[model samples]
Target: MEIINFGKGYPANVLLPHTLMQKACESHLQEEKKLFLHYGHKQGEEKFRELLASFLQQNYKTAIEKEDLLITCGASQGLDLICQHFTKPGDTIFIEEPSYFLVFKIFTDRGLNLVPINTGKNGLDLAELESKLKAHNPVFFYTIPTFQNPGGTTLQEEQRQKLVALSEKHDFLIVADEVYHLLDYSMRSPFPFCHYSKRVLSLGSFSKILAPGLRLGWIHCCSTLLNKMLEDSVLGSGGGFNRFISGQVYSFIKLGFQQQHLKLLIGSYRLRSGALYYFLTTILPDVICSPPEGGYFLWVELPKGINAQQLLERAKKHGVTFHPGYKFSTQKKLNNFIRLSFSFYDCDILEEGIRRLAKCF
Candidate 1:
């Protein structure tokens, strides 16, 4: 039997716009091939940054200056760069109890200590956050605040401001992974955390909105913090990271294809996520899960007395797979939970996966 993969969060192959990207690359080559081939400014290509700032400002509904943005190969590289510049080995950093599972590896590779902050249905546990802050000073609180991976929950605006204020008072930076900001079905993405304070660094990637192979992303921080990144030896020696990819992305956004393609992604994902959620609620009424509003995942809590790992073992026999929630937890405690991704398959396959998962119960 062909296994239905509900655990993978990658966009479906049909969803990738190869033709659109080809057009962008061809346009860039026709206009200015030699400039992109040569070394770029350490910060990035100047006109590219300007275009991106305008694109973000229009979408974010807040002012974003080119000076505040630094281009990167991708969000993962951006995080590594920030950790290298701002954190030392053995320094403490806070993360959500259940976060983007892969993020732990980046911090662990850098030798930073990880602390888990409880995340709830609403968002981060603020009281728990303050209590921990009293005991240990963290170099940064790295969080995926909007449409958090594996959780699909967003931090409210009030809490966002409070968190920034705490960061200001404690003199710690807020590293926000906001790569999913643009895929909002609601169309009104929360104003980014960087808007609240200079101490906040927000990461955005074209991987989620466009194609992942481009490996193009940007970091938004105040000019002061941006300079620290600009001075990093990697960029100083290598010039801009992914200069050629940045040029192609610049053309993509300039041609208005980015906006149009983004709309297509949002509409398709909305239907896919809704179908998965509907099938689950209708077929398996006992399971508990939140309705997905945006992003790639729907976090489900199995009925009491059912362990997700055991369910997965049986689910494999039925040719369906999902990520057991323990993988996302810092403390290894959410054994009864599972994370399902609606972005990788269409509604029919999603419905079938739910049915196969039901048989495991």
Candidate 2:
């Protein structure tokens, strides 16, 4: 039998817009050759930033200007660039208890210590956060606020506002990973975190809404931060990251292809997430999992006396696999949990994957 990979958080091949991307590339390249084919601007092509700003304003329902944007190869690169400039090797950094697992590697690779803050379906535990804030002065609190990975939680608007205030009070930056912000399916998350303060740096990526292969993303921050990076050697020496890719994407957004593609992705993922949730509940009644309001993942708690890693071994034997929750933990604790992603497959495959998981149980 075929292995069903519910742990793989990737866009389905069917979901990728081949035609739209081809059209964008063909249309943009067919135009009069310009500086985009050369070293390009250090802060991305100006016209691309202008179009991105307008698209973001309409989608997020908030105001942002091109001056606030800085282009990067992708969100991961943006995070690494921030750490390189803004942090020291031994500085403490706060992250959600179960963050995007790959991000844990990013910070750890930079020799930064990771502190796990409590988070759940309701969002960040502010009381616990404030209590911890009294003890550690972190460089920044790295957060995935909307439809967060693994947890699928969205921090409320009020909490976000207060979080910004605390950031100012404590003098720590707010690094918001907002790649999943526009992938909402009936979820009304707060406005982009960068809007609340200049201390907040919001990272947006085309990897999610568009195609990951494009390797285009932007950091939304204050002019001070943008100017600092613009003058930095990483950008000044090489010019903008993904300049050519950004140029082609200018047409993608201009032609209204991004909006149309997002709508299709949202609709498809909604059905898949709901199907996975339904199967888990009906087939294995003991498992505790909430239906996601948006985003790609479903975080599930195993039944009593169940260990996720041990279950995974059995699941592999049954031709299904998922991410054990401990993989996402900084302290390696949440062994009774698991993360399943619904973006990679259809309902039929998800159902089979769940049934295979049930057999493992």
Candidate 3:
């Protein structure tokens, strides 16, 4: 099928380094041998945590310790674990209106009442956030701080500080999903929320920038809460984690190959994003697209009277498809918006996809 799928944030044009697999195989043969085939530990491997902690501290400026980090299958699972540990059924949580919808489903499935907070061009509006804090005294405020999903907007520096201040003032925790943190289009990558507050629980994953198949992610928090979370993970998932796979990843980082690979990937995506943005702006002038700071997506607001569903129907006929905007909103009112991912396809495919989308418009 000649398909142009701008629907998911999946990496399209990349492949996991064959070298990584070969290295993992070699490591398994040398390090674990028979033990490599066994079940993984629940808490994740120790070396992976240490490597991650050091990487985040050195590169991202987050003072994360090995004790403060817990590995998960990915950040998605980390979200589930956080919900399972912190909030109970009937507790209130604040979510960005146009959020990563999987979070909304997770909170709802766990029986938490969600209060949607509207985000502005720069990111979530602090005034609205404070109002919700006063109204609900929510258990936590969940946000995708950088290159936020669907909106592709990064939180401004002042706004980030305001969020931290609100969490402290109102005594609520912040669950930061920093999955897209490494995808920097910003002048400088924004600081993780934990830098400003101890109450913040930040989630990250290697899925976006690295191999999603790794299913490796981490949660970082302060001492007391992180201790409880680690305990919870042990009870919930059994032991530490997959020693074999984690060991391989740890080895990769120790050798500085992972960072080098990521830098190369980021450079490639930067070019793709620029080309995609230029194509869309030049072809679809009437559409309102966010100026992404650093992330894989462009949240385009179609012309006022255009029906996204109707456009999608026509676009599908031309072998191109994009996510409808309504899927990203809690209230399901953002019908004229759609999220386009430039991470997957080549420039030629992207050019064709934009052309098809333009025809729909």
lDDT by candidate, in order shown: 0.90, 0.90, 0.81
Error of 3 at 135 (Å): 2.2
Arranged by lDDT, best first: 1, 2, 3
* Candidate 1 off by > 4 Å: 33-35
TM-score of each: 0.98, 0.98, 0.94
lDDT (Cα, tens digit) per residue for candidate 1, span 23-98: 9888988987474788888888889999999998988889999989999999999999999999999999999989
Regarding TM-score, does 1 or 3 come out ahead? 1
Position 313, candidate 1: lDDT: 96
- Candidate 2 stretches greater than 4 Å from native: none
- The pairs that clash in candidate 1 are none
Error of 3 at 351 (Å): 0.8
Q: What is the C-alpha RMSD of each candidate to the true structure, in Å?
A: 1.0, 1.1, 2.0
